[model samples]
Target: MKKYNRIKLWEGLHSSYWFVPLLITGAAIALAFFMLTLDSTGKSGLMEKSGLKIYTGGADSALTLLSTIASSMITVAGTVFSVTLVALTLASQQFGPRVLRNFMQDIRFKFVLGTFIATFIYCLLVLRSVHTDAEQPFVPKISITVAILLAIASILVLIYFIHHASTSIHAWHIIREISDELESNIDYVFSENPGNSHPEHKRQLVEEITTGFEQQAYPILATGSGYIRAIDYDRLMNIAKSKDLLLHLKHRPGKFIVRGSKLVRVFPFERGNGKLTKEINYAFILGRERTAFQDVEFSIKQLVEIAIRAISPAVNDPFTAIRCIDQLSVALCHLTQREFPSPYWYDDNDQLRLIADQVTFAALVDDAFHQIRQYGRQEVAVTIRLLETIATIAEYTRNKNNYVALLRHANMIRRGSENLFEKLDREDVEAQYQVVLQRLAKI
Candidate 1:
């Protein structure tokens, strides 16, 4: 449960727009105090005597400089905010709303906003310390000098932000970024399991574990409603181990559950009491929306959304759709070579502890291409690209099931395109389909 909480906290911080900037703001405040302390302790005089260049202004000049920088920074900060909104709006209108999360999670964007706002606050703090009314008028020369440096740094950040914001909204850039995320998700989802079940043994093991348990199993109901963002498998295994129980997970991450729905099924019906039910529920983390943390399909859906939008009648951008297909194919190719984790989890004594839903190549392939195929039916280029991608993925796997999934999608693409395409278009798509057939046959 502690692990699950940590995952939630880290995900929250990653998705937050304010957390990073707030930290930067705090650092700026600390820097202001440190520089003021240096001036108050006569460190600025010592630096000047040592031939180090510093602010040489009296109290009035220091106040004016700080105030001008402060006001200008505030104005520029407003402009930065507006620019960020414009970029987000353009992304939402052009791409899907899911892409906005990527923009929000961007460290570069946060740093840019933080730098400008921090500079504004720094100048204001430094300006407040400048005094001209006393006989011994005081000026925090070091702090003002640091403020000047910060203002210069903020200007450079502004220039880079403009460039980054402009390029980030391009279709290929967004697609590639999502593609990279998909690859990372694939790696994380598949690489964590302790062992991979062989094809010959997986079915036998599942049958042995599940035989006759359905009639006697007690269902654990969900207490809340939301997507299953994550589940602590270690916690579930520990609970099952300690209680001498058999647990079957009813759903996996990326699945949605409503209140009172069957969440897990426990064997030996009488063992599932209120205390045990609460412990089981604690292992599953529900959220208002799905995340890519343990859900590989979440990222796959992001790519599919882009491809669907690109090939929509309103957009008619086949090249962008092709780009998405290429990226998905790269991820599928990587997936084909990896062994999938077995759903049957056992304890150290080799006793079955939990049965969970396994992520398979077939499901992933469908998740990546299903909606795009449905939406891109009328587009011959997209159909051909999908077949080409499937063919490319087929080259990486010798598994019969993987070949079957790839071949099935290829045939589906051909069938979907037959009536929609003209003569030449139909020929092109059919040719690609045949290439996929030949590729798989060779494998």
Candidate 2:
């Protein structure tokens, strides 16, 4: 079904149509029982002269007649209740927030009221049937007060059950919805924002990037040489087309290529001047290309927002987090050249950028850590702390300047973490930290 129709179905179930019928049925059942008591005693009591006369279809038998009517009504109500209960359970499982809430709320409330009326009426019916064996006759010294009290208690329990069921089903609906959305968006979610809470969001990292490596390249030296002729991209395209390279590879717009390297291979059809223009700053482009990190370009704003969410209570601290990730992204923004994979190529600046990025990422984790304490999730806290340690290790290894700047955030977040991650192995983080500290000592 369409989402809106499902929502409509939710509305219908919660609508006055179903509710009115349920309430009417409960009242009818309760009334039938009330009528049954009156008929069982009133007509029978009037007919009784001295003692009780026991006969099935004899005497002015109003009791006998209402019970027969009540029996059929109760049977029908029971079947209807059972079927509606099943339908309610199924609909609650298959839908979203608004729909599920409607289903759970209406059905639960109706059932509660129905059950109380049904059970209480049946109890009254049973009470009306009691009699003494040897001496006394069927005597119901029916206290109006006690009967009313019993009815009230039964109704109260029904209300409580309805409330509790509604609450539980609402929680269930959210968990399922979150889990489904997580499955679809999880990869993009993790790739873009590594600082996000994985398991709490109902997913874990698929490929964990453990010990990172940096591939360095030295800038070429030239004593201001004469410029070369602009190479025609049309001719290059023809050559590339013949080799079927355009089909095989995906290339970025600007590439700083070696003299012997093929610039492009393509299926040819191109214009003249715009296709091949000699870029004077090719050497600088090459220098920038060798140190690039990111390949794709998109907004980092969302990730920044996520960082803020993770560390919300302690600080609205979005700027610090955004700056750190922005630092990392700046290094990435330069990787527009299509060559090696991201995270491999970088200069010393990129290394420090990586450190700054990791530090900011870890600091945002402070919010998650603080929440772990605030919310009392020891298991999630442990997972987040493990990721924290891993990130700290990664950041600490980057460079001295970034290390000195970021590790100072330790004082800010050190309060809650003292006893929390105590059982987790610190060697991974400590070893990496020492490696950075040692590198910093040399500088």
Candidate 3:
């Protein structure tokens, strides 16, 4: 059996829409051929005895029917692809291009395409067996019946796909989907050990690593240019343990690194023995795009993109912006309740061997609302909602530093609203600002 890193395998599968469906389509074709072969052998007495009169036609009739269905399937498949491309184009134009990944990762669309192709392949495979030969006229009754059923299934799926495509492009649906994904990613990354809030330990470790690196560490420059997609931490820890060296990573997942950038600094530089540099580089996977595997900020940025698009002058949709702010607040509230993992990694012997970068609450809050706040400055409702979101998050969090960050954002929103709104609109914004301050006072 082949083994794969579960996270990497899942990331690969999630990044593409074709692999699994292609496998399924191939398997369907093989299965159709196998069933037809079994029927030809006259070994399956139960299949022969079954009184289903679905395919009561002769070989010629079956051939004509299957061929027509296969052609129709191909036409429908073409139509589906056309509809998908149109939807993708619209989504890219309306929302940012980052959302193209969402549509591409959509399982429903992939399954619909796969179903049409698989059914067409199945029919084609079974159609080949329908022949009027010299000794026997062969017609795989069960296979033809299955093909007919699949054709009907394809029709139903087409209807569902049309409805789904239309509904999925709506702003609310897109925002909600992004929000759900962000929430799930937050839970996945932060839902362990909520009580461990010792930032001092992490700071101390970072200081020690910095000082150690300055004294004896050697820097490893990046060999290529791309975003850091994932880091194999377990393998890195093992290498660090084996080499008895400390490794300090210069970039985190989702960060872009250019060629010759400092990728990592190894302490006791001579301990790595030159070969460890290649192994260290192997641990860090670079790609053309960022992924949500270890990058929670990428998920946050999706919502921000939608919010920014909503507030743009062409869209001028403040309600959608408010909805995004609400979702961002919910995500930040959940984030505050959870403990972020320490950036420092240790070996089995409790030796600190790796120093990785981490995403902070302040950074997430800024990424979540900064762009929306900037784009929505002219809209009073959006500004008020921004303050309300900050107030809501402040109420949910116990950390003084988080409260400070929320207050800082609240101040920025208040400052931005001063010139953007009329007298009454400014009053409304001021009321929300005071409410946020009151919430902070209680905190």
Candidate 4:
């Protein structure tokens, strides 16, 4: 069979089960034709010698009325042939090969048995005309009983195969989810927040040579671009080593990560691999770009985690919190404007829409807006006025100031769209921006 194996390659062709009825029909036709030819020129009866008797008083003869050998054979054959064409064609055209492949793998052998038994039963019906004056025979034909048995067995086997195949596919999906998640985390950290760590701040490396990273760790979310290196995550390991921060590394590859998700906890070890302690601080929190996620459910969960981690530093160390929040806000806003214009600087709604149940990125963005507003809450009028001015120019700057809502008011505009910047007086906005720039310069 291996040398020119039909069985090995048969699956590559259309499903064998799809031809089940056709095969039985073909067999019935062959038996009918052979019996008719033996009986001769549609006249003579080989039936006389066989000693069959007709018991129906003026009952219609099956042979003369139905043309038992010709019509039954043809009907059986047509049914088989048409069914095979319909099933196989539907599988290929409507469902496509992937689903069809799974289906046929389960039922091929039983289908063959079903065809064989059905043909045998058809042959028994032909036996009726082989003998003459055929009444209902007192004893059933041996061929009829045997064929029925095979049909039953074949159907049972088909059922078993179907059950087995479905169970296998369900298990496979779980592992795929895990591997996909890890790749997502890498994309978010390296690409989405690259160049700058957040939306509101320019990324500045904090290099120093102390035990400053003693208990430092951060989460990597899978919302950004997935792992760029298709070969593996060797790129990240190399980056860690380059920054001289590759101390006691921890983490198994191919694990899913959420946003702000903490990875292997570690402190800075002996820094030597080209990493300046003060210049290259750990930028653990990361997010991928918009398009990287294929599974929105998986990616959204990761983003929410990153958001939670983002807020942790605020309570633990407010100064560091201020820096982290500033950078994240800026980075998020930059990421948004890169694609379509969004009213909120960070609207993960379109991309992570599927995982909305798990991670409400909208809520996180709204929360960050609230957290940052507290900074301007102090009675310092200068800082408060500066915040409002900046909010007017950079809408992202307004998120914490309740200024974005003012810009986002759908009711405020006559056009029925809430893009305030589009309708705002440009000179007034520019004037506000210049004032903030002066304040920023002074700071």
Candidate 5:
């Protein structure tokens, strides 16, 4: 049996709008049962002596009212769902499919769906409590009134959902949301003083990992094919410490792997127990698609997708592309300041227990601008923004190698513009390119 991390389970539930509502509905039904019981027992002083008029209606009237509300709620729920699907379809078409996940994960959409379903369930549960006895009828007055309130609340949520869905699909909102998410993900993954910011530090870490130990290692093959979503570093480190073994991860999160491919290489080549292999496999959480939780690059790619869509000839929306570039610059600026985790994981005694690949600032810089340059080279506004983004990122970092990376990308943007832009447009791009060169020269 394959064990999944809790993060994966929560992510799956979070992406869907149904889970929370279903849980709430179940709780509502249970609460309805308890509250109806209180109303049934006339022995309670509050129920017997309340001045508020309890439902004085007969069972048939109560049934008709509850049934009508229940039926209407369900009908509205269906309509809301239909509208949600339409919104998602339009967003995917207009923005790009990458952002569809953001729409699916919107809390407003989930709350609206959950609210209606919960109201319907609450009504049905309360309706069942209206007993039709010829001599002594029973009515859960409080529960019925609560149901009415819920129905009203559902109406409010419906209105809110309409407004949210309309605004969420706009190009600016989508770009801003992706950018905000990218910024937060960068903060989560990188620390205040990323040790690998400097070239010498990065080279030292690599040298230590490569030359730290000499042991015969055996490869652990992946049982499935998918993107590496998350890795259980604590567990892998514990396994290495307990067994006195060294583990070298072949790839990091966001990398795709095929079945039967080497996932990790375990040292000392001893086949003593099958448990080690199982534990090693369990540490890797593979999924059909990449997620933003542990993969910062995946978030970056989301912004990239929007930029690509904005610049496409079908859209010709360079302003939206420029907005995306501006946000990417924000994300890159934050990333440059933070410290990336070392690829080498050391044990308590300072011995290297794991060698996992880590993301570098240079690689991130490339990921941020390479694709946009390829697609947006013809658009002078986009190309100018691209050069400006690189230049802004260059100003924030102290690392010399990062300066080199920025200059290289700046040169690429200049060359790409010269080829694609008209002579006049090319001049404007060169002007921006010179600004980037001046910044790099100061560094």
Candidate 6:
């Protein structure tokens, strides 16, 4: 499997509610058998020799204790499941459905669920071994003791889970979590500086290479319709390099495609074959919804969703919107200092093999704030914060294009505020707009 495919598979498993519980339950089963082995072989008496003296009761007492633990654990497990569902519902309603992915992927919630289930299963398995009416009475003392310890540990997990579920639903916590994720994704995606000293020089080179290929290249149409969750760049480039083909990608991750839509354009139409089409299709992973794996815009959209909802007429919570803006500013500032990868890909021979669609800084800025500005225009505080965010981003950037994008948004905010804000509020916004201009003016 490819690296990203493996990562995606793991991510799918990790984000699920059942995977951890399944693993923990499996471990619990294995542990039950192991403890039974020790007890049947008379090895459990070693703990008593070591002065541990834990759970040294008879078969009837062991049965009663294990039964109590098992029943209590199953009940608590049900309670945890109910609480988790409630939390998920609240998160979806308040933070948008996309944000529920964060709660689903939370390790604490999964661990608590797993611990309770595993404890229940462990107690049941141990309870099955206790028999008072048998010819040779037997009680797995060690297993019963471990069950007790697990019960105690489960109580602590329950307490921690209660705290986690409560705090995780708070607006500020959700906003900060997404902000942290956005910053991390920026670092992951845009880690390298431009290879060429001038970006325009590289753009010209790309245009030169693909000058007449558009007319002659064979177009590859998508077979299914969905959002492009991730593209296997290495696989795509390898297929192009091996077949001596030049592939031009028509869309990037996060783009929705319809059946029969153009997915890629292949140069030298004579070399295009059905097998090559299938292989190329195999390199793209489509899904019902967008993911943050390679699509940084998905995270940006989540924050924007929260901000717009907060500023809506029903919510009218500018403070939450401001928190979102603050977090977005932090991410944008970090982004301003990073370099985006070029869309052009070359082989070892320095011959261009792939022309991939790329994400631009301007597109990202628009994604991060355009909707917020549109929705929050009438709100003076949100408008001023929008301009202030631009100013903050301006301080970290040296790129001319970044300055232009920031200035454009600042001017738009200024224009919107002039029509909506009263005299005193307009002065506050105008002051922030001037600060943005001054910041962008610096070297």
Q: 34-127 in candidate 2: lDDT tens per residue?
A: 6457655565455455455423332224344434434544564565456556555754443222333334445455665465445446545544
Per-residue lDDT of 1-443 in model 3, one digit per residue for the tens?
01224666666787687875697699887879787976777634565567545566787888899999999998999999899999999999998899998888888998998899998999988987788885878888778878889999999999999999899899888888888888888886676421123345566755765774656888888878898877777777778888788788888889999988889888887775457778888888778888786678998898888888888989888888888888888899999897777777766555677777778899999998789888888888888888988888888898888888899899999999989637999899998999999989987
Model 1 off-target regions past 4 Å?
Answer: 194-205
Clashes (backbone N, CA, C under 3 Å), per candidate, total: 0, 3, 0, 34, 1, 0
Task: State, as a TM-score between 0 and 1, how close model 4 is to the true structure.
Answer: 0.22
lDDT of 4 by residue, 234-262 (tens): 33333444443333222222224443333
Q: Return the TM-score for each candidate structure.
A: 0.97, 0.22, 0.92, 0.22, 0.90, 0.95
What are the runs in model 3 whose C-alpha is more than 4 Å off? Answer: 1-6, 43-50, 133-135, 191-209, 346-350
Cα lDDT of model 5 by residue, 1-443, tens digit: 13347778888898877787788788788878877877777533475486665565667888888999899999998998898899999899988787888987787787888888888988988887788898877767777767777878888888898898889888888888888887777776664222122344455755755663334577788878999888877788888899888788888889999998988888777752467767788888988878886678998888888888889999899998888889888988887777667777777666667887788888988888999999987888888889888888878987787898899999999989878637888888888899888888877
Instruction: Tell me how far the alpha carbon of residue 355 in candidate 5 is from the true structure, in angstroms, after superposition.
Output: 1.8
Worst 10 residues of 2 by lDDT: 350-359
- The candidate that wins on lDDT is 1
Worst lDDT 10-window in candidate 3: 192-201
In the range 184-280, model 1's lDDT, one tens digit per residue, is 8888877886333545645676687688888889999999999998899988998999999999998999999999999999988999899999999
> Clash number for model 1?
0
Tell me the deviation in Å of residue 207 in model 1.
2.1
Q: What is the lDDT of candidate 2?
A: 0.36
> With candidate 3 superimposed using the best TM-score fit, by how many Å does residue 293's alpha carbon deviate from the native?
0.8
Model 4 off-target regions past 4 Å?
Answer: 1-77, 97-100, 103-117, 120-129, 133-443
Compared with the true structure, the alpha-carbon lDDT of candidate 4 equals 0.35
Q: In model 4, what lDDT does residue 285 have?
A: 22
